[model samples]
Target: DCSLAAEQLKNSPRHKAYLEGVSLRQLQKLYSLLKGHLGGESLAESLENDKELAKRKSIMDELFEKNRKKKDDPDFIYDIEVEFPQDEQLESCGWDAESGEEI
Candidate 1:
């Protein structure tokens, strides 16, 4: 069924263009999600068994929507840099402490 659906999409011109815009990393991530959802269990049963996965999927969906950009968009930038303002003092972690030994 999945292969048939894929073949149908491949044959469709509209879907073929859409698929061309999708990256391999995105496809791999989608395949991973589908594998988790269909791993020998019903959809509802799988969702009930792994609430964390459902939560993660929702978060990822939200992030994807928030950060989505079109290839032809005039405002799209290849490398974006964002800096978050720090309002609190920086805390030192054990790993970041002075090791005292020179390499």
Candidate 2:
């Protein structure tokens, strides 16, 4: 019922402003974290049997927990710009290359 909780929070008078101040990308990330928390489609299977998925989920959870900020937090910035350093050469994708034929 994560979605339900989110809906309730969104509609709550006390939290409505805080949610409104949050960006769509932040909300999406929250949704992703919540979905991961729910164990996704592998809920029926034991996490021990799906070590890879569990590991990925663990990493995601750690990252989200480490980086998450509340809308009301004094240090919370509405916008943030982060540049990731690329040490390796970029690979070109087929979809990114233009077809020679004109439309």
Candidate 3:
């Protein structure tokens, strides 16, 4: 029903600016506020009837869970070595140029 309404809105030329102006955070907040006021019991009941929406919601839930897990993981490391030297421009730390062994 929301998608049907969204499709109807897409046809309206005036709705473009109004829809485009709304940020993702604003839309999410609005959805949460509306859902809270509407109550959760009937929401679940109605969502159960919309199989397509329910499927999409389930996938989104799974993805969000995975994302949270990844964020909370202790072993995750994001390291970047940006300035790797080329072979010709490389400097010796302990190895000689000819022998390539520790000095």
Candidate 4:
């Protein structure tokens, strides 16, 4: 899903133009949320059927370790969809092209 978002943004003149409008931290947070939501191992079993999303897995693997350490509760399921921007909104807005996520 995130990958498709990136690709979609890449094809969009408005998204490309808006890329310079956000910050790094914002991008990272968005990436983490998307990864935790539409990611392959997410609770949504049907998400796995998305070959486009699966092929374009997270590029922010490094954030995983840092994020795990920062997690307020390790045992928490940490539902991201509720924790941050709604999927529909993010999809409509698109993310940083370089990282293929919010920034």
Candidate 5:
């Protein structure tokens, strides 16, 4: 993903204009610096399946029920969603074009 993002940004006229005389290497370094600030992917492979998700929901429901008795907020609600990254996505981001391996 980082590599793709870098490529797109490098090709973008606005990005080029903004950076002015910055070299390709410097732009790449900038991308790496900014990518770190976007936060990491949230993935627990064990929790990707429906069965595991249901189990997790059940545990959360129990905890919420217990907390309900101590609180008076009836409008409160909790929701959870999990996503599994695709192979192409993993490759585009995980594999560094320059290094030709997972970063």
Candidate 6:
């Protein structure tokens, strides 16, 4: 959704930059949170079958979906915008200076 909002703001120099920055920070935070979780195991599991911990982990996974995507494009993995050269009009239009399309 954020990526779509950014697209709508692309025509406005100020708003586009602002939204891009905010979305970028969101991405960074999401990355750090996922990295932390992926690199470690559950801190505690009070449930004998670990059901609670499993549920907690699943919720976290859904929040960002580190491996979530459509057609394996790197951009769809997040709420950030993506650019494909052939789909753009301007010279290098797909390449937004603020964020890489291939990201």
On a 0 to 100 scale, what is the lDDT of residue 99 in model 2?
98
* Per-prediction CA RMSD (Å): 14.1, 14.0, 19.3, 19.6, 18.4, 18.8
Which is the winner by TM-score between candidate 4 and candidate 5?
5
Sort the predicted structures by lDDT, highest score first. Answer: 2, 1, 5, 3, 4, 6
- Candidate 5 local Cα displacement, residue 48, angstroms: 32
Clashing pairs in 4: 23-103, 27-102, 27-103
Off by over 4 Å in 5: 40-103
Q: Ten residues in a row with the worst lDDT in model 1?
A: 1-10
Q: Candidate 3 — which residues are off by over 4 angstroms?
A: 1-14, 40-103
Candidate 5 all-Cα RMSD: 18.4
lDDT of 2 by residue, 1-103 (tens): 4455566667789988879877555555466565665765344343334577779999999999888998988999987999987997899999899999754
- What's the residue-level lDDT of 24 in candidate 6? 55
lDDT against the true structure, each candidate: 0.69, 0.70, 0.59, 0.55, 0.62, 0.55
From the highest TM-score down, the ranking of the candidates is: 5, 2, 1, 3, 4, 6
Model 3 lDDT tens row, 53-88: 778999999999877635458976666368755667
Predicted structure 2: lDDT: 0.70
Which residue window of length 10 is worst by lDDT in model 3? 1-10
Tens digits of per-residue lDDT for model 6 on 1-103?
4344345555467666555556554544444444445756333322222575678889998876765677668565456688767765765564465764443
Q: Please give the TM-score that candidate 1 achieves against the real structure.
A: 0.28
Q: Give the candidate number with the greatest TM-score.
A: 5
Candidate 4 TM-score to native = 0.25
